[model samples]
Target: MTAMHRMTLAELVGGLSAGDFSSSELTRHFLDRIAAHDAQLNSFITVTEEAAMAAARKADEARAAGNAGPLAGIPLAQKDIFNTKGVRTSCGSRMLDNYIAPYDARVIEGFNDAGAVMLGKTNMDEFAMGSSNETSWYGAVKNPWDTERVPGGSSGGSAAAVAARLAPAATGTDTGGSIRQPAALCGITGLKPTYGRVSRWGMIAFASSLDQAGPMAPSAEDCALLLQAMAGFDERDSTCMNEPVDDYSAGLTQPIDGLKIGLPKEYFTEGLDSAVEARVREALKHYESLGAELVEITLPNSHLSAPAYYVVAPAECSSNLSRFDGVRFGHRCDNPKDLEDMYCRSRGEGFGDEVKRRILVGAYALSAGYYDAYYLKAQQIRRLISNDFAEAFKQVDVIMGPTTPTPAFRLGEKADDPISMYLSDIYTIAVNLAGLPGMSVPVGTVDDLPVGLHIVGNYWSEARLLNIAHRLQMDTDWHKQIPEAFA
Candidate 1:
């Protein structure tokens, strides 16, 4: 039998359901791996051993009672941004280091209701701000595929952990390209649910309008499994839609032959690395070989996404982060002249430099003098960006592109330039602006680092996207291949 640490989340769940393994046995296997390798990967910020074991025991009991679900005994990691009951939810910021949540985020509650075991919290960018995990207060999360490079962020730890087999399928939140970019760099499958599809009640706010949670795993089928449990509505999040959540896994077995796939004309343009473009183009041919039709589509306003998103996201963030003024919770200043001084000093000390920069940018953009020039203009651009998608979808079932411009670059390659790091999200950001669903599936690799094939669908096209991704996986060895370092 293969070692537990090398198996996919789907394989583990199947084994448990068939009585091939016990939850305790699987739980211990992951705990042992975490103890052994997490020191280098920094994939986890917290490991919930007691809670995991108790949940595993409960799963065993449920199986005894014939109450097993697809993920009954599966142990998975959570991004620290999620508020887990009695568990620390740091959002990778020092400000809330000691703050434990009194309640689980709606996504966490949904997963618990579905019988999945909680592995622990994974590290991420401070307030989900940076494209690389180096922005984390804890430390950078190393790519399991190439330790010398980054895993990608702000969902960096979630992707790295899944790639490293630290957990089966972990939860991640994307505001901009966090989930998709990390999944690409880490060589896994990750889906960003359509905005408002998943309740964000307990997720620590990054950019309230853009932040969305989803699943990351080794394969698209596995992403479907986890997404099934994490999505839905909560009255607490007014932005959460009351619409019905469909079974995301239903399309995993369906062939995508005859489906219309549009390739954005701009996605393959300048700034794209040759190797990455070649790999993604080949993946498209593979889909064509499977009978899917491909056509060229234009998103004329595509270049406007980074500029527009930078404005809108920071504006929302400035308002959301206003709560961290030292009086309520999180880090507090030592001795202060007055309450106002304490509030100012604590936030200055707790937030990272990048976060502060965004706050300042956001504050300025929303200020009366600059409102019409920046914030208002960005909102108009956002609508135009979304309109581009609406036009493209009218002619195709989905859109496909390279999840990123290149494979994971060496650590510090783009660390000094914030604009460079933001550009890494080019392929994934427009989907967020449109509030549509997007996914990243392992396609092939360049050199040793992983590359991802990006797939975007109209709102509620998750099932179709997963099905196409799974069928593509069936035809190739990409998803099955693990990093040589681990082997």
Candidate 2:
């Protein structure tokens, strides 16, 4: 109990079961930590003290009745993009400053039914648009490891909150690298499940086809427990897959021997930081020692990922974000010349710069004459990117690489250069483009910044990915490598 801050989800559940601590006590500890550190971290946009306490009380009642589940009473933070009933779900944008969802997201309902306590909503890039969380309307989230550096975005706040242990685990959406890159920078474990694996009905859309929600927790095993509660097909979401929920935790003991993991030559090429490559290679070496085999694979069109992603993601975003034109909820302008002025001034003042840039880019991509040259071409390339993953999967059980090209950079490092910021997600964007599952786990640290080892799995391969990560975690101390201050 003395090391409660570092305890994993399994450990916490077991401790709670044995009467070592009450759910309320555990929740208080996290809440206290948030209050103490969140000012500097800026991880949460809102903290639901009343709801969390009510849920904790109910969880204690369930435990007294001997009907508590493993996930019962666990306090979880959610990315602000998720619409939590009565909570301000801003998606880190000012446009939705007044928007209060009347209903919970499908994932939120799942967690609620499972008896998980809602801690609050974490910050993210505005509408999940930026790679570096600098685009958030609230403000940038600082990396827990290095306060001067960023926590990675659009899911930066989720990762930072988990890394700082403000909450045990949280939910995050990945459009490109939001979850994985932030998890990489924050030194926690994050997973973007296969597209359609989770319902997206109430999540604020970034890029409809590419955005997928997943878990960000202390480790992959925790992700399994969370995903167990947070995942399932929902009739409300057309894209949600109508499939049986697999026993993800049951596969934690599966053997990873003879697993063929592809290491894309493109990922290790120039522009990848030497320190990150070193640590990833070392992790891959450990995998090799476990009897897993590695092969150099070629994804010839990997370089086109950013351009293709920008084009396709923006086109989807422009259409999705049009709902925030001051009439339907959200923020309104102070004065309006007319209907057109109301829309223009509202959007012009409410949305941040990066958001406007994306809207313009996306609108142009989908515009009349240029649609064929940009949006259509991007869609075609997206198919090819997905095809690349499918082809690689035929010969490999999974793919491996560095989550981010480098550890979290200084907060303002890429703030001025959008292209450079986009490049930060180079390693992670393909998974979204291909609609494949991907994860980021801390494998090592470089210059005090934690290095994330990226794991890519084929369709519906989440359990397998977790198993591989668990084995590696058993043999390595990477997960134990917390930032010096937090430790």
Candidate 3:
């Protein structure tokens, strides 16, 4: 039998249903794994052992009564960005370090209703600001592959937890490549569903228009299972679409024989690491061998994505974060001279440097005089980038590219250089700007570190994207490889 800790989410589900192992035993196996290995990875921010055990026991009882839900008894990790009722819902910042959520986010509610057990809250970048997990207030999460290297951000902790098998799968939110970037670095499967596909009522807002919750796991099948539970429309989140949720797992085995893959010339340009590009191209070749056609496409405004995102995201962030002032929830300053001082000191003391930088940039961009030149111009550029994808989709079923320019880098390597760190998400941000679904799957390794092949699909095409990724996994073993230390 496969070791409980090493099994994928789907396998665990089957094990539970077949009575191969009790949910309590499975939960304990993962909790033990987290205790034994997480010291080196810093993947988890909180461990809800008591709550998890109770849930697992209840799941076992429900199954005994023949009333088990689809994902009954499965243990999963939730990114701290999601508000879990009675749990510390810190978005990896001191400001909300003491804030306990009074209600669960829509995503959390979905998982709970599906009979999933929460292992704990995973760490993340402070307010989901930085590309590298270094911006996390709790400390940077280490890659399971190499302890000295980063596990990408702001969903780094979730990616590391799954890669290390601390949890079978974990929830992640991608505002601008947060899920996919870390998944690529950690060698796992991650999906950034179309904006509003998954409700964001309680997920901490970074860029309201771009933030999305998705799944991160070992295989596309596991992601399919998780996404089935996560996707739906909620009236609470106005931005959430009323579109019907598809059976994400049902289409995993669908044939993608005549699939048209778009190879963006812009993605193959300078600044891309040679080895990373090689792996992506090799993956493209594998798809070609599978009878999928590759076509050349262009996203001319892609070069402007970074610049535009910098303006638009921060502007939205500035507005969203304003509610964190001292008088309300989150960190409050002690010994304030006045109301103004309290507000200033609480925010200044609570926010990390990266968060502060973005807030300043956002405030400046949206300020009276600069609004037209910066914010508005960025919006226009964003529309052009979106239109680029709209036009390209007319010729292609999915867009293929490198998820990141390079594999994981040393932890402190880019900490001092924000610009370089921000560029880590260069290949991923445009998808968010265009409100499309994107995912990353492990194709191969470069220098013992994993590289991911990025797949972008038109809006609401998550089912096809999952099918394409699952087909590749069926024909390859990259997604099955685990880090040596963890293995």
Best by TM-score: 3
Find the candidate with the highest lDDT and give its number.
Answer: 3
**Who is ahead in TM-score, 2 or 3?**
3
Over the stretch 1-487, how does candidate 1's per-residue lDDT look in tens digits?
8887677777888788888889988988888878888887999999999999999999999999998776887899999999999999888999989888889999888888888899899999999998889899998889998898999999999999888787877999999999999999998899998999999998999888888999999898888888889777779999999778788777688877798999999998999999999999899999999999999999999999999999999999999999998887899989988989998999999999899989999999999889999999999999999999999999999999999998887789988899998999988888998999999998888987889999999997788888989999888877766676554
Stretches of model 3 off by over 4 angstroms after superposition = none
Which lDDT values do the candidates have, in the order given?
A: 0.90, 0.90, 0.94
| Candidate 2: segments with Cα more than 4 A from true spot | none
**For model 2, what is the C-alpha lDDT against the true structure?**
0.90
Candidate 1 lowest-lDDT run of ten: 478-487
| lDDT measured at residue 412 in model 3 versus the true structure, 0 to 100 | 95
Clashing pairs in 2: none
Per residue, candidate 2 scores C-alpha lDDT tens digits across 331-437 of 89997989999999999989999999999999998888999999999999998898888888888999999999988888888888999999999999988999999
- Scored against the true structure, residue 313 in model 3 reaches a CA lDDT of 96
What lDDT tens digits, residue by residue, belong to model 3 across residues 423-446? Answer: 999999999999999999999999
Report residue 273 deviation for candidate 2 (angstroms). Answer: 0.8
